[model samples]
Target: MARRGKKKGRPVSGWLVFDKPVGMGSTEAVSKIKWLFQAEKAGHAGTLDPLASGMLPIALGEATKTVPYVQDGAKVYRFTVAWGEERSTDDLEGPVTKTSDKRPGEAEIRALLPNYTGVIMQTPPQFSAIKIAGERAYDLAREGETVDIPAREVEIGRLELIETTPEGNSIFEIECGKGTYVRSLARDLGRDLGCYGHIATLRRTEVFPFTADDLVPLDALEAAAPKREEAAPEGGRPFAAQGERFVALDAFLLDTGEALDCLPQVAITDDAAAKLRLGNPIILRGRDAPVQADEACATARGKLVAIGEIEAGMFKPKRVFAG
Candidate 1:
């Protein structure tokens, strides 16, 4: 057999906190980010609907291993609900399936907030990524088939009514655990208040371990890309413009260990790091060593070594990292 050639693209690794603009799908953003960086691998921590915009943490190369950490983190969204219309898709993108002239008073909305602020059962919108019988709910809905999407418990940490617009819209912000749907919140809120509603504007401001402050707009990122040279150098291969650009973009990436920030960290010596890399357990020594931890990360000389479970005073590697 012919020797397998090296995989294409750079092995760039880190999180790019992207401020994804509206109208761009999450998968599309990941593909573009990968191409721009010439990365060998890329993935996103959470999915942001094309209609929504904000903190989308795109992980490249080794950072992809930590995606679950960010996905499990709480998310914050600021959204506006337009009263008098309930759309089939639960947002402005869908056609209005129901409408009512009745509008919700600010007081009525404020009173209802308390009822939604906590753990509650919520039915996801018809046009969601939820799978039913191995098929996407949205695909079935698009085919004009109504799927029975069962309600499930979702935690709403905070729900605040920021302001009610005179145009018959209410702006609210929420910090919610994973799988909470803002569209469902608006739809259910309207039903309780005797006013049909749909999401008019939605923006995700934060994903745990990242915030609006870390966001970089698509335009800014495109502008940062290096301009490519027109021709190859004489008697030599073309100048590595793509490689140079990769270096330039690398500046924007957050450290891969940043994704594991929520987990407790333990510093390990080179000897211990070597053992962990070989899929062996290392005994935790010293008085300050943790007796036990359900999950924690070990670092050696400021570099991540492994994420593992501590049991019986030994750290058993679960996922090891390559430098």
Candidate 2:
């Protein structure tokens, strides 16, 4: 058999914090971005629903290895709950499942906020990405199959009612940990306040290491890319040219190590980096060197070597990076 050819696309590595517009799914965003960057591999840190918008961090090439860190960090969402109606999907996208004539007052909503703060058990929306028996819950929900998604422990660092609209829509901003759902919060709040509710609008402002400030809108990225009309072959796709357009687009990518900044950074010697790259442990020197750490990153001459564990002054590689 012929030797398998190397995978196509550029060996790009970094994170792109995208401001995903509403009506675009997370997977679609990843595919589009991968093509634009001409990257060999691409993945997203967290999934953003079609009805939601904001900070979606897309990882290209080697950056995909750090996705879990971003996913496990705190997330902040600003959402609006339209009172007096509960939808099947917990958002405006779904049909109304229940309704109530009752509307909650600001005082009542404020009082209920305490119940949701801190660690609490919450059931994910039925029309969610949760897997059950190797099938997506949303698929079953679309076919009218009711899924009893177990309530999971989620942390809400803070929950505040930003304001209430005259139309009975309550806007809220929440700082929460991984796996928390704003849709479920809206549904439960409505039930507690004797009013039915669904998410009217949802926008993620932060996903740990990345924030709104780092977000680059889709249109901006598109405008900076080489156009299909510029293709040399009339009916073929435009090749990724390492010109002004590519440079402009590449400027948006953050360093791969940016996602790992939260972890302890160990400056290793060139020799130590070589050993770590070969899947070997090296003794850490110096009084300031960490004697023990569950997770840390090793860098040599400002280049990431590996993500590993530090025990008894030894740095053991868990995952090594490719330059």
State which candidate has the highest lDDT: 2
lDDT of 1 at 256: 89
Once fitted onto the true fold, the runs of candidate 2 whose alpha carbons sit more than 4 angstroms away are 229-245
On a 0 to 1 TM-score scale, where does candidate 2 land against the true structure? Answer: 0.94
On the 0 to 100 scale, the lDDT of residue 59 in model 2 is: 97
Q: Per-residue lDDT for 27 in model 2?
A: 97
Please, what are the lDDT tens digits per residue for candidate 2 over residues 12-52?
78999999999999999999999887778999998999999
| Whole-model lDDT per candidate | 0.89, 0.90
Q: Model 1: per-residue lDDT, tens digit, 238-276?
A: 334345545556788898898898998999999999999
Instruction: TM-score each candidate.
Output: 0.94, 0.94
Among residues 3 or more apart in sequence or in different chains, the pairs in candidate 2 whose N, CA or C atoms overlap within 3 Å are none
